[model samples]
Each structure stands twice: as structure tokens, then as C-alpha cells.
Target: MEPLDKEQQLERLYATPPVYEWELIVNPMHFRTKFACLLSLTFTFIGVGIFILLPSLKGLMIASSPIIVGSLMYPWSRYLLNADKRHYYAINKYGMYSTSEQIIPEIAYTIVRRSAWVGCAICVFAAIFIGPIAFVGAGGAALMSFTMTNFRSVPHKSQCLFDGYAKLRNYRENEYSLYTEYYHYGFDLMIPESKLMSIIGVIKQYNDTFEEEFVDLYKDSKFQARPIILEIVR
Candidate 1:
């Protein structure tokens, strides 16, 4: 085999760092529990308020409101849960087998903005209802909103090796890409697809040794002048 270059050495170090046991995180945000609480509490309060206070509904809200609110909230919760599952699975279970190289800034922006706006709208509507029951429902909506906005579990929870950077794939076209938070310039190393097991070591080594070098190298560089590369490791 050809001797590895300095960059290759660094990449290898990151992909296969020494470790005892890989940490597996499931349900990192506790969203499953959070959603359950939200649904249960919102319906519980509404059920009681409508059945006892109004009495005309005759516990109708308990039976029917759940279906209505559930129809609206379930889809949102399902989407949020799926997003969380994808992220956690990648980091904790799959161990970064393959990653897209294009550090698309637009993708992150769109995801964040859309999620935020949707969450904010739900919370705002709940807030406007205005009553003790409204307060409880609004609280549930607000929690869901905050959770959805910050749903990605890996980076936020400090599991990834490098912090990522956002790049414009196409400025006028609005295409974008994402990069490791601290990456070296002129040294794009995409791990081979068949070498999936090596990624854990690679990430571990990269974080342990060269994280500082990677960050310092491009910390002051002009954004318009950065080379983008992606790695697809086994």
C-alpha cells in the first residue's frame, strides 16, 4: 500500500480512534415521552373542562377533541420523531457509515426556519385561546415547538467529532452544503464506502488530535474561498 500522506494519517487517526465501547443513545431528546405528555395533558385538561364546566358536551371533548387534536398533532409529532430517529440512528447505531459532503447552508437554514415557524405558529395559536385550559394547552404547544426547533440530537448533544460549517453550493441558485465544524483546507478526505467500521476510529482520532489544527487553519479564511469535499466511509 502507498504510504499515507500527512492528511491521510490524520484521516485514519480520526476514523479509528481507540475506545472501550461505543456509546449508543436512543430517544436522546425524550420526545416520545414529551409528546405523550403533551397529548395526554392537553386532552386531559380539555376533556375535564368541556365535560365538567360546559356539561353540555357530556364528555364529548374528551372523546372527540383527542381525535381532532391528535389528527393535527400526531403528524407533526411523527415527523419530529422520525427526524430524531434518523439522527440518533446515524450516530449511535450506524456509526457514521456514510455522510453527504455538500455542506449545504440552505438545507440547514430551511430545516431550521421551517421547523421553527411551524412550531411558533402552533404555540401562538394555543396562546391566543386565553384561559386556564388555554394556558395548559399553550404550554404543551410551546414545549413541542421548542423541541422540534432543536430536534437534531447528535451535534447538540456533543456526540460528533467536529462542529460543522455551512457552505453555499450555489449563491445565486441558493444551493448550499455543510462541512465539519473544524476542517482543514485543501484536505478533503471522504472515507471509502466499504470502510464503514473505520469511521469511528477516524472520527475519534480526528477529534483527539487534529481538531485544533483543522479549526485554526480556516477560522480566519474568507468564506468565498473554501474547497468543499465529502467523505463516504464504510
Candidate 2:
């Protein structure tokens, strides 16, 4: 029989009922908890600048543009934080499936268009003072940003099959989340803290090479101080 294609694999994965399921809602004030004062002061200054510098409608809009753009950081950060957005995860012996809120394409398109315009403006400003060479750097920056934004805008469903070699990392700080890696691709599953061991046991049955370790597989400098409670590599 021919090997299943990507779509077929997904359909099979989704059709398989999960043995375990859970939901996670990240802290709504996570950002404010970290940057409350800084963000508040920054927006306050922007508000003052808008009123003081821009007396006319056009000037007001232009001057307030920074605030308008900066304001997006809140909703965008909240979206990234998954604030108040409940994420659901389902897992069975065959694989795991997860879902989260999807982003609106219209909003994504607006952001992309504004980003390109900002890049164009920067290019023109730089070219006026620097030289024609500025276009090269600015154009490259625009292209890279556009590409990254477009790629991220595409919807993605996080899922993985357990029929192959895989790695697992359980962070000590977050007892409710499990991070798994298959090949170079990685995804996270949020499970009840009490059931972590039971879930690990289920995974171990399929891949006996699973073991515990303190080492950080990703070697991320920031996470170096964050202890890993358990790690399994196959």
C-alpha cells in the first residue's frame, strides 16, 4: 500500500479518539504582571505627545500613529500569551492533537500591509540622507519581515504521532505542560499535573528508551536556570 499523505495522516489522527484530554488558559495579566509600569508609562507619554504636538485632525492621526501601532502590542501579546483563550489537547497511544484560537486573516493582512508601508517609509527616509544603498538594506528588511509574518499567519494544528522515536522534556517550573520533539519539529501539550506520571508511563510503553535527565536539550541560555524535572530521549 502507498504511504499515507499528509492530509490522510491528519484525518486519521483526528479521527482517533483521545484517551486523555485537558484545557489550559494562560494568565490574562501575564504581560502586565511582567511589564505593567513600563507599558503604562510608555503609553502615557504617547498620549501626552499626541495632544501636545498634534492640534489638527491629520496631525493628530499622524502623531497618534505610534500609539495606535504600539497599542496592538497588548492584543497581540495577549494572543501570543493565549490569555483567556482556552487551548485543548487530546492524546491517545497513536498520537496527540491540540487546538487553539485561530487568527483572523483580515487582521493579519492589515498588519502585513502596515508593516510594508512602514518599511517603505524607512527606506525613503534612509535613502534621502544615507544614499541609494539604503534601499538594499531596507528592502531586504521589508522582504524578511513580510515573509515571516506571512508564514506565521498561516494556520497550524499541533499534532504528532508516537509510532517513531521521540524526546520529551518536563519543566520543573511548569508542572502542567509537556514538551515533545519528533525529528526537529517540537510541540507542547498541557496536561493535568496529577496525571503527568500516568501520561509519561503511557508514552514509555511505546518507547522504552525514555529516561529522566536534568540537561536542557535545546541549550537555550535563558532556560538554563529553569530546571528540567524530567527528560526522555529515544
Number of colliding residue pairs in each model? 25, 0
Give one digit per residue, the lDDT tens place, for model 2 in 41-113.
4654664575576566543433343443345444444443223434567777667777754334466656655
Query: Model 2 — TM-score against the truth?
Result: 0.54
Best by TM-score: 2
Q: Name model 1 segments beyond 4 Å from true.
A: 1-12, 15-52, 55-69, 83-133, 150-234
lDDT of 1 by residue, 1-234 (tens): 997765565455446634323222123232454565576566555645555654553234223333344444544444443232211113322122222211223455457546656656644654454334543434544555566565443443212224333221222111112235443232222222244345434445434332212234345655432222122111
Kindly give the stretch of ten consecutive residues in candidate 2 with the minimal lDDT sum: 225-234
Cα error of candidate 2 at position 120, Å: 18
As a TM-score, model 1 comes out at: 0.30
In order of appearance, the predictions have TM-scores of: 0.30, 0.54
| Runs in model 2 lying further than 4 Å from the true structure | 28-37, 50-61, 64-82, 102-156, 175-182, 216-234
